[model samples]
Target: MAELYFLIYVIVFIVGAVSGLLYSYSIHLEPFVVKEKFNIPILIMAIIGWIFTLNFSLFSMIPSFILISIGVFLIGFVIDMRPGYGRKETIIGMIISILIWLITHCVIL
Candidate 1:
């Protein structure tokens, strides 16, 4: 459906924006803490949206599922990058995220 494609496009745009926003040395962007509770609303919203679309003839739920998965992965990435976290853990987290992203796209999209 068009909504699925739209969500996929939005996700790609968001990742690109995040990459640039999180790494702007000229702007002196500082990393901030992201509490686990902060993501709960988004998680709930995604799930609700997916459930709402289940019987509808409009949006497909696959892209929303993928989006929510990536959002969770990004939260993990932020946690792993926080102070006192080991570099190995950050690397592993990123690797796992990449795998999940690839598998989700392959299996769902």
Candidate 2:
């Protein structure tokens, strides 16, 4: 059962990352060029998502979504604040994460 939940978490995280990547492209962020640049931040966000899933419960869906969204946003915001990176790719990532959470929430319920 635990393994199944972890697998679901992994799938959700991948979908979120893909969503973020597509969004970045739409916004002209040139994801392919910046792929190496944002790898750490994306990994951090995935870890956050993993932790969230570990404690996730149906009744706490709204709060969980909010937390995950904030986590993604912060990861982006922090990375943007760094010296070299200027664009707000983190916002795009947050959108992807929120979308994933919403979709999975609906499916699970």
All models, RMSD in angstroms: 10.3, 11.8
Instruction: Give the per-residue Cα lDDT of candidate 2 at 107.
Output: 66
Model 1, 1-109: lDDT tens digits are 8798667656654564454344333234346533333334333433333332232222365455555445443443333333432233334444654555556666667
Instruction: Please report, in order, the local distance difference test score of every candidate based on alpha carbons.
Output: 0.42, 0.49
Candidate 2 regions exceeding 4 Å error are 29-109
Those runs of model 1 whose alpha carbons end farther than 4 Å from true positions after fitting are 1-85
TM-score of each: 0.26, 0.35
* Most accurate candidate by TM-score: 2
RMSD of 2: 11.8
Estimate the lDDT of model 1. 0.42
TM-score of 1: 0.26
